[model samples]
Target: MDLANSGLSGEAVYKSTCIACHGGDGKGAFPGTPDFTKSKGPLSKNDAELLSNMINGFQSPGSPMAMPPRGGNVSLTDADLKAVLGYMRTTFEK
Candidate 1:
């Protein structure tokens, strides 16, 4: 799992890093995960905002997990984040 250089595909990265919480189908887990499929109004938020949140993290006043800074994998590059976001947008946000 050479995430640093294997140039893992978005789907691969998602499966390896995101599926644990976001779920294999991007439906998200219980306890507090946001269900992207059911997102109302506009799931397409500002890319920069999403990127910042992805890289830094989002607490949302009382979020318990704190989003784990880069979703818990600091090795992810900007491109990887963008790809994951794209994957989510294409797959989950119906």
Candidate 2:
């Protein structure tokens, strides 16, 4: 996807890389994936914590699988992660 030069918007990144599990509406598609609409859900975490998890990968308490580093797209930069994070917060947080 040439992410190195694409400068993709957060929504684009989310659609291309995050939608499969996170879903179009931010509701998780998997058995234990987090629901972004909930006030106390994963979005409640601060950016630093969320970024760290995204960079290093994280498995929620009951999630069936761990989110791979950079949502499985290792080419994504810190800026991209932050952008996607912001997008999620804006688009899904209640």
Candidate 3:
């Protein structure tokens, strides 16, 4: 998917890019991935911190793999990241 257009909604971006690992339920499909449904999971962090982590990439403490910069999609803009972050919070945060 060419995200260069910047018109995709957060849910769309998530279904296309994030769902592979984060899973549709936000429980994580991969080993060591954080559980977004947890009350104190990764979503507990403030937006700025979350954005920084998403922008620069992040590796959970025990995760065997790290999320590449921009979730490996260089075409995603800061807006897209924010949108997806909001989506995750609304849909998954407990």
Candidate 4:
């Protein structure tokens, strides 16, 4: 599928997997929620690190909810994560 069509599916992936806490627009509902629209937080991190964190929950000393391993949704595949990541990047990474 084209990027546009792929993105459409990606939107669904994002909604089902990320919308609760990240908000419908990926703006986040609570504090510390990364504002995807504003490109805030650790945007400087490379894609590899971001992908790693997306696959494996961060286990640092200060993480809340332990980042919820794969954001607590295990059914997602790597492609789904990539699609969701692409969606977030397009939505907020401006």
Give the true-structure RMSD of model 3: 4.1
Best by TM-score: 3
How many steric clashes between backbone atoms does each model show? Answer: 0, 0, 0, 0
Cα-based lDDT for every prediction: 0.69, 0.87, 0.88, 0.68
lDDT of 3 by residue, 1-94 (tens): 2335456678987898999999999999988988999998999999999989999999999999999998999998888988888789889987
Name the lDDT value of residue 79 in candidate 2. Answer: 79
Reference-based lDDT, residue 28, model 1: 62
C-alpha lDDT of residue 66 in model 1: 60
Better of 2 and 4 by TM-score: 2
RMSD of each: 4.6, 4.0, 4.1, 3.5
lDDT of 4 by residue, 1-94 (tens): 1344333366788788778878886667766666667644544566778778889976434435556777798887767777777777777675
Question: Per-residue lDDT of 1-94 in model 1, one digit per residue for the tens?
Answer: 1224435567766887878877876656655665667666124576677768888877644335667777899898877877777767777777
**TM-score of model number 2:** 0.91
Poorest 10 consecutive residues of model 3 by lDDT? 1-10
lDDT of 4: 0.68
Candidate 1 lowest-lDDT run of ten? 1-10
